[model samples]
Target: MTSAAPTPHTLLTPGPTPIHPRAVQALTRDMLGHMDPVVFALNRDIQQGLRDMYGAAPDTFTALLAGTGSLGMEAGFANLVESGDEVIVCANGSFGHRMAEMAARYGARVRLVTAPLGEAIRPEDVAAQLDDHVRMVAVVHGETSTGVLNPVPEIAELLRGRDTLLTVDAVTTAGMEPFHMQAWGVDYAYTGAQKCLSAPPGLAPIAVSDRAFARFHARRSPTPLWYADLDGLRDYWVHQSYHHTVPVNLHYALHAALSAALEEGLEVRQARAAHIGQAVYHTLEPLGFRHYVQDPAQRLPTVLALRLPDGLNDAAVRAELRQREISVTGGLGATAGLIWRLGLMGESARPAPYRTLMLALEDILGVPGLAGRFTETLTEIEDAVPA
Candidate 1:
């Protein structure tokens, strides 16, 4: 009998990035009852770790839901946005558009402020969209589509002193960048375990400020989604009230992932991400390439959006890279076919793989002089990777 071919797995995508071996082992740990004291202790530790990761206060209503980043987004909208309530959504990429869609599903009157793909939304533009009727202002901290980092701090400053709640999607920015929930005045924020956290996808790490919790308390109508209801989920996660079955092993993995982040230190992790991102840009820039987002300061460190070479097939190049055991991603939504989304996130966000990708691309594209430059870039990057 012929043996089945070995399965291959290479995740260089923006999300669901490569998981650490230790975290994967944590997932195989023995399971416990969700309400067990041991489980509760694990839960508490994870919540505190999340707060530390986000630079949030201890009293913040932070919880982990058993789902991807989208589940957290739904939870935020379902709990905070009531039917017919007006919300201002800033859309520059696919995830921003997704936030608006989720709000609209919750019966929110979504007033969208859009910027072109690969562009950042100016705070002035957001202020122009604000009205007395708007209850919440939603924005994506790091748009994975075009690798543009929106000006959350500026937008938050603009919304200060106003009754409007500020919600942010930090899915790609959470562990990879510097995000301070309390300092930034973000009322609610959500991220996934897969991206910068370097864990398997499933658990959504969510944080809500005291003011956002008060809004939840004052809600007159029921949340549209049952599983994503913050009130109910909070009861189970924080208050220890049984609502549904919690994934015990997944929680183990989450706790381990957070522990890894704490060990690495948030500042160090952020710097590492930034360093790798800059290395990638510097390596590509001299090869007649341009970034999708012009401003380097406003780009996401975890995801890089590069313009495809003239006359080169973007999809074909991605496929070629895959054959070499690398898996970069394509653009999302409106950016499809226009850019390549290279993720330098988590475990895979290192020099070796990135250098390998560059060399492989050079070999395939027959780009003269790339090999030598790639070698020099690799040496520089290797020296820069954290000890």
Candidate 2:
């Protein structure tokens, strides 16, 4: 007996987003030794690409950590928070809460400034939690769990001119949204290769402002994690010194992905993301799915969390979609079993794949004309927006 052939999945999840064609092609290229001169050159290129995408200051230190986005989160806290350091974490969703937990684990005196799930964290609330003892303020630019985009700029303004450093988790917003680290007074920011970057997992791109670097340099205690030490990473990435074996193929893929993103221009890519997000929202609303994030301004265009219609079993629906070769994630933490987390990120943020997804959903939900309505609506949006 012959087994069934495997199917390709259209990934529409919060992370490990669809990889770009250029990145996929790069992954197939011959590998280079970790210490090869060409590898260092690729590191420089990746760092520069990150700086450009983040609008980082000229003196910023940028590098890629050989881990997932969670590692980036740990690096931010480990490098900056010393024992007894007062840190304010803005917890509006699951990612924000993770930062709070991580900060505490890193020996910080963690103070949580929280907002309800699906709502943007108020900058004033963060400001209220601030004190002279506060050493840093951590916020997630895009909360993947709830589809809420927090006001990082406003929160940065609260830390401006103060000794406090502002670190942002841009895991979902890195390539999808406009992020001006310098202008926004962000001291540190990090993202995953698997998100809007359109590269595969196993790399985390991080940016460190001079202010943040200085704080790390002044830490009385040594950083806890040897591998995550920014100084060691800097020596490896910036000074071409060996620290560990860098994943050469992932680097190649990331370099190609960044090159493609830059070639397309961030403004154009952002416009496309916005267009796709709106298209998804409009197409799904009439099908009984409701946006979990009530405020449109606070919603993430990359990852959308939608509350399922009454009587629909979340796991069963997701399982059905997966069987159809369409993969979207379910809600996380408190949102589990109540919502669906859909992503239209990077290479997946296009009309055709979403059309396929809609058609599949139509079939599953027994809605006869859903796909036609989606196509007509998308055409109207494309004509209006030119994405």
Candidate 3:
């Protein structure tokens, strides 16, 4: 007997989040010439929206690339760090390690300040790594691998009054978390449209401070990567200089997504994320599960990392959940078999899906006491739901 394919459902992963209906419509709208006035207007609106979302200074230059979050990571490093420069890369998770790799690819001498997965980097440790030769200090604002939220504000304060420029990977925290680029003293920052922005995967929204741009201008050798070179891409995005053909439909979708974010208000969006995260913590703690990150303050509201039960097969548990038409991710890199990372991001960062997930998981794990607790929790959740 043939079983039908699992029913399609919403994305509960950290990135490529659930898209708004309006944004989906924008993607289906008639495509226009890349150089058309209408397309250019859409690009302008996206840039402005990005600037507002980042809380960038008025003079900061913002651009969008036809790539994912990794492209933005490469762009920021390729444009800023030249050969023989020293850079400090914070490595608390997979994404932070990627930054170090990109810097090394560009010929920079990369020094790593690493912590165990699920642990935040101490600002003093970052400061200790800084030296006269260090040109940049790069950190990830939200490490999706372990659900650890790095203290970017504290790290920024440590770099204050220093010659080293600060760069942040806010791919998972951009719209959902509080990221004030100018106020946080981040000279360069990059994020993906798919994550907190709740847009489809494609465009990377990036912002650069005046100081970071000056460094780019001062590079003795041209940045090697053409597709990501800020000096050239900035002209195309801001001046309409036409470096390459733009993605018209994606830009329209991004514009609509940004508009929705603004209408929801950043504060409200952040509060929603926090509320869902708290509920998840409360719901999961009594199920014989424990968080990977011991400190609540270091955990991100969008992603939660749980240590699997002793003797339980992580992959099999994930497969069982998949059978029930629910999906959650495992940890990355060294923590893969040891942890399960559940993302409560954007539209999926709500109570209903989480409650459903808890019920499904309780049935799968089938621990002695978890089923009863899960039943009680589901009843409480149902009672809380509006009529």
**Model 3, global lDDT:** 0.83
TM-score of 2: 0.97
lDDT, each prediction = 0.85, 0.88, 0.83
Could you give candidate 1's per-residue lDDT for residues 171-279 as a string of tens digits? 9888776789999899999999898888888899999999998898899987668887877878987889998888888889888878987888877877777676767
Deviation (Å) of 244 in candidate 3: 0.7
Highest lDDT, which number?
2
Q: Give all TM-scores, in the order shown.
A: 0.93, 0.97, 0.92
- TM-score, predicted candidate 1 vs. hidden true structure: 0.93
Model 2 error, position 247 (Å): 0.5
For 277-375, candidate 3 gives per-residue lDDT tens digits of 656666677655688999989988788788876877888988888877777788787888898777766777766677677667667766454435545
What is the Cα-based lDDT of residue 308 in candidate 1? 73
- Please report how far candidate 1 places residue 125 from its true position, in Å: 1.0
Judged by lDDT against the true structure, how good is candidate 1?
0.85
Q: Give the residue spans of candidate 1 off by over 4 A.
A: 1-9, 367-372, 378-387
> Which stretches of model 3 miss by more than 4 angstroms?
1-6, 366-387
Candidate 3 lDDT for residue 345: 65
